[model samples]
Every structure is written in C-alpha cells, then in structure tokens.
Target: MTVRAVRRTSLVEQAVTELRRLVEGGEWPVGSRLPGEVELSRLLGVGRSTSREAVRALIAAGQLHSRQGLGTFVASIAPVTDFDRQLRRAELAHIYEVRVALEVEAGRLAALRRTRADISALRDALAAREQARGAAELVDVDLEFHRAVVTAAHNPVLTDLFATFLDAVRDASTEMVADQGPSPEDHKHDAHAALVQAIEDSDPQAAMAATRHNVEHTLAQLRPERP
Candidate 1:
C-alpha cells in the first residue's frame, strides 16, 4: 500500500479503537453526547475528514448516532445489548451457519498444521471446561477452547470469521443454557475431548465428525420441543 493509504488506514483504526474504548470502558458512557467534531479531531490528532469517516464507520457499526444539526451522541445506553436483542433469531441462525462454514475449514487446516504448543493449549482449554460446573463458567471455557482450536488452525481468515460472531455466539449460548439446564456441559466436554483427540491424531475426518456432532447436539437442546 502507498504511504497515503497506510496513513489513512492507521488514522481510521486509531479513531475506531479510541472510540470503542470510550464507549465500552464507560468513559463517555452510552447515550451520552461525544465531544464535537472539532474537539474530537484535536483529541485524536486526526483531521476533520478522518474523524468524520471514523464517526460514520462507528455509526454503521451501530455504535454511534449523528444528527444533522444537533450533534453525534453515544446512541444508546447499551448499544451492544440493544443490537443483540434487535438481531432476530433468523439473523443469529445465519451467523451460526457462517460460523460452521469457517470453523469446519479451520478444523481441516488444524489437522494439517497443528503444532505441539497448539495441541497443549487445546488440551488446557478442554480441561478448564471439564472443571467448570456452572452454566456461565462452562460456556466461557467452551468458547475459549474453540477459540484456541481455531487459532491452532493458524488460518487468520477463519479466526476473523469467528471473531465477527463471537459476541452473538456468546449471547445465544448463554440464553440456551437457561432452558437446557447444565447437563449438556458433560456432553460438551466429551465432544470437545473427542475433537481434541481427533486433532491430535491429525484426523480431519474425525475432527469434522466430532465438531458437527457437537453443534447439532447443542442446537437440538436449544430448540423448543415439539408437542
């Protein structure tokens, strides 16, 4: 990339990161108005145009709101919570469908390229899940385990794909636990153990089977029962 391109990208990224920290860290808080364009531009050390672009991007991400004559504000008291609630069940299902596509590919690559350190990390994550007794704790470990496995695959694209849906997945899984009870935690650990073993054996087919099986099982538990 050209110097200008690099500079623009850096400025946008810096602005976004700072803005996210402000909102999420509760510095500005949600629903509060941010500093005006000129003030923000000076604060971020960027020009007005860069700040405007950054603000527009955050608005698109559902993080901020801008009014023509009024001003830009934090939008909502809990934008992430608001977005998660507004994202329909169909949207979440679509997210999971995408996750499956990316994760399956990651599993295949992990079978091909996993290193000793990656294997150890996966094992540790699985152990953490096994030790977790509560729903929230179990879900946390389960996600960390999957994240480690995906990272072990060493496919940045796959990791990015999963990262996009991480929040949605966490929200969905937490809701799922409310109905399914904690019994599934045992099954989850078992499935992950099998998946880890498959990765250790460098068996892509087994890894895929283990992964698909676990996903389907969880989906079944989460879905309402038919009369």
Candidate 2:
C-alpha cells in the first residue's frame, strides 16, 4: 500500500521475492494492507493466479497475514531468505555454524559502526553475562550480549534476520544446555572480552576473529568439527 511499484516478473518465486523486498526494505511497512488481488497482479506484471500464489507463499512464510474480510496485511518483515525458513529445521551444529558466520560479520560491522553508547550497552550486557550463575541464566545473559553486538552493526536487515533466527537458536541451546550442561561460550570469557576490545578499538578484523574464536569454542565442544 505504501510502495510505488513491484517489478514485473512471470515466475511466482520472482514475484514473491520482490514482494518480500518491498516488505523487508520497508517500502510496505508492517501492518499495511496489500492492494487487492487484481491490482497486485497488475503491479507485479504477473497473472492473477501467480500473484495469488505469491501472496499465499508469503503468508505461509509468516511474512503476511490474511483475515476473513479485511485484505491481507504485512505480518512481519522476517523470513526474508530461505535460510530463515530452514532455521527451524536445522540441526544445532548447523545453527552454530551459521552463528559463527553471521556473528563474525556482525562483529566486523559493529567494530566499524559502534558508537560510545553502543559500546556502553555491550559492556553492560557482558557484565550481566559474567554475573550469570546457572544454565538458563547464562543463556539469557549470553543472548543479550550477542544481541547487543548485532544491534551495534547498524544494519536493519541483519538485525531482523538475527532476531528471527534467535528463536530457533534459543530452543536448541536450551536442549544443549540440559544435555551437556556446558556453557562453552561462558568458558571463553577472554575471547568475549577481546571482541568488545576490538569493537572499542574499531578493529574490524580483530573483532571478527574474536567473535569466531568465542562462537567456535562452543562449536568445538558441541560438534567437534572445525568450521
């Protein structure tokens, strides 16, 4: 409803991707009702059935919500990529692997983009993490600290993607915590501190390396394979 145009595409996937771009890119803000089926099809330069399928796909992906009488509205900007859709089905090992990859980039971005206030928040989160006593407590604090790092990256898309993925990660982490009860991430406090230091110093490479070191510490303990 807020956007100007949707790119013409014949295929349903292309139409869906473009629609997702509109939603994720904030062209169509959350909760905005989409144009009627005919208008949407015209905008997308696709047939009515094709556009309908695309809308349905987005609804299934939880990016759109459809009501009985009211038109379809944007539910979320999440499920932006296939990776997000697959995260729920992914193994813990795979999730950790993705975490290392994404968090490294997040660290690098944070190092380059973080402000004084961001650094202060990160330090506060890490302090809370350091004081955590049990597995659940540690999980809560750990997520907070990592979320602060991602937030410092100054990338809205990455921030949204990470938020979407955190749900799956949290469930798996709870299982892992109960099974092995090893907060291997907590064991690498030095690496965590180094990540903060790197960000404070604006050293992107060092920030990435420290993030890798810390996440991989947990990975090694859980999966035993190097990433």
Q: Candidate 1 on 88-137: residue-level lDDT in tens?
A: 34454565666676677777778878999999999999888788755556
What does candidate 2 score in Cα RMSD to the true structure?
16.4
Provide the clash count, candidate 1.
Answer: 0
Number of the predicted model whose lDDT against the real structure is largest: 2
lDDT tens per residue, model 2, 115-204: 999999999998888887756567767888999999999999999989888855665565466446655556557888899999999999
Q: What is the lDDT of residue 33 in candidate 1?
A: 88
Looking at model 1, report the run of 10 residues with the lowest lDDT sum. 178-187
Clashing pairs in 2: none
- Pairs that collide in candidate 1 are none
Q: For all the candidates, what are their Cα RMSDs to the real structure?
A: 14.7, 16.4
